[model samples]
Target: MIDRKKIALLICERLLMEQEMLRVNYINTRDSIGFFYIDNLLPVAIATAIAESFPTSSEMKLKKSLKEDKYISAQMDKHSEILEEVLYAFQDPQVVNLIAEICELQDIYPDEKLYAGGLSLMEKNQFLSPHLDNSHDKERQRWRVLNLLYYVTPEWKIEYGGNLEVWPNGLKAPQVTIESKFNRLAVMATHNDSLHSVSKVLVDKNRCCVSNYYFSDEPLKSSDTFHVTSFRGWPQEKIKDLVLRTDNFLRQTLRKFFKKGIVENPHYYKKE
Candidate 1:
């Protein structure tokens, strides 16, 4: 069984080797939805082990609504131990600090509770509509600074449709698609304007990702303000867009009156 320390070591070594190039890519995209991805992030054997250990769709919790459709699980103990090991490896101090330096960010911290973080799987026809992630952590204490997604499904293709879509120029403009390639780790800066989504899955296979988010004492951008995870439909879906907009507005409004909202979100780990 791979442990967090070993996984973190492999990840740090890979990031250090590609540090310069990743820095450049991130800087160039900083004006938009700044991000970078590293391929072959781990040894093929280790990557394969992690990928193969993923829990089936039924073993995870399904999140289905107008905003998104996917299977997610933050309850690490309920699934394969490798999944939890890989997930927390990204949270290791050395790994987190190294990633922050590459992105030229400071004061960033990893989420231990895995709020909206953990394992995610998308099956046929499932999708996450374009939206900004909720700006803060569970307690609304820290600003969600970066989104770290490590795709592990072997040979997942671009045409399969479960790719990461960045609407850097806004929803009406042509969005950038980041393939959910195997053994690739994608890190993206998240702020008020960092709008992104997952394209619908078109094939029968599952697209699996080990996800984590880093938070900070301050916002990524000076102008960023508190907001809910706002969702919007594709440009052509006028009615859906309107409905989603209204939904976003209502949720945002509720947050103002109730700092944490009416109910507690059940997506975080409940360690015993």
Candidate 2:
């Protein structure tokens, strides 16, 4: 069972009460990177249940590459009942609309198919390089607008790493660190220049999060342009950075000329 009633009750009680305040704060600080987080997003008991139910890193698919080491899976049927319920709770239409109001976006819709939105598990040494998400869905119809991240790992701390870093002024300036605090929810706009990444995890334990993205008919910025999921290494990784830059340019060029590309992206859930 999805247990949406329970999820809805908690969200309505905890998050809906602060919608207007969050809207003002989100608008006031949205010019660059544009994000805000709410701690203790759900009751501690529910959050603990979700965290305890998360599949181990070994159970999820290891997306090992230069960009990240996290385990990600969109196949909800394969996970525990509570995991699916909590993941989709963010997808609830009312919840989606409320978040849209907070982020000041219109006609935004949650991705029920879970394309690039699902469970994420990171363990020791896992990290995600700074990068801009793909500007659109797998089919390029709707513009990917907002990234909704709900961290559920219990007792997670700032020092544990895996914190989200946003580069509002590009990579040269110091980044803003948003700790992946347990039971916290982060909403950040995703567009042409929303460069962000997760710092490497230092502890041996696993960090888990439920992620979802909202899409719209129009791009966030009128000047937004289409692009592939671009990546760059840490500031000190001079050579890797250069290589990734070249790689990004090539991918962008390919995407511009070939819209959907020769082969489809394999990241989406292939429901049977």
| Highest-scoring model, lDDT | 1
Compared with the true structure, what per-residue lDDT tens digits does model 2 show for residues 105-208? 77998887888889999999999999999899877899999999999988899999999999989888899999999999999999988999999999998888
Report the error of model 1 at residue 127, Å: 0.5
Clash count, one per candidate = 0, 0
Q: Which stretches of candidate 2 lie over 4 Å from their true place?
A: none
Q: State the lDDT at 110 in candidate 1.
A: 99
* Model 1 bad stretches (over 4 Å): none
lDDT of 2 at 191: 91
TM-score, cand. 1 vs. native: 0.99
Q: What are the per-residue Cα lDDT tens digits for candidate 1 across 1-272? A: 87999999999999999999999999999998999999999999999998889999989999999889999999999998888999999999999999999999988899999999999999999999999999999999999999999999999999999999998999879999999999999999999999999999999999999999999999989999999999999878789999999999999999989999999999999999
* Candidate 1 RMSD to the correct structure: 0.7
- Candidate 1, residue 136: Cα displacement in angstroms equals 0.1
Model 2 vs. true fold: TM: 0.96
C-alpha RMSD values across all candidates: 0.7, 1.4
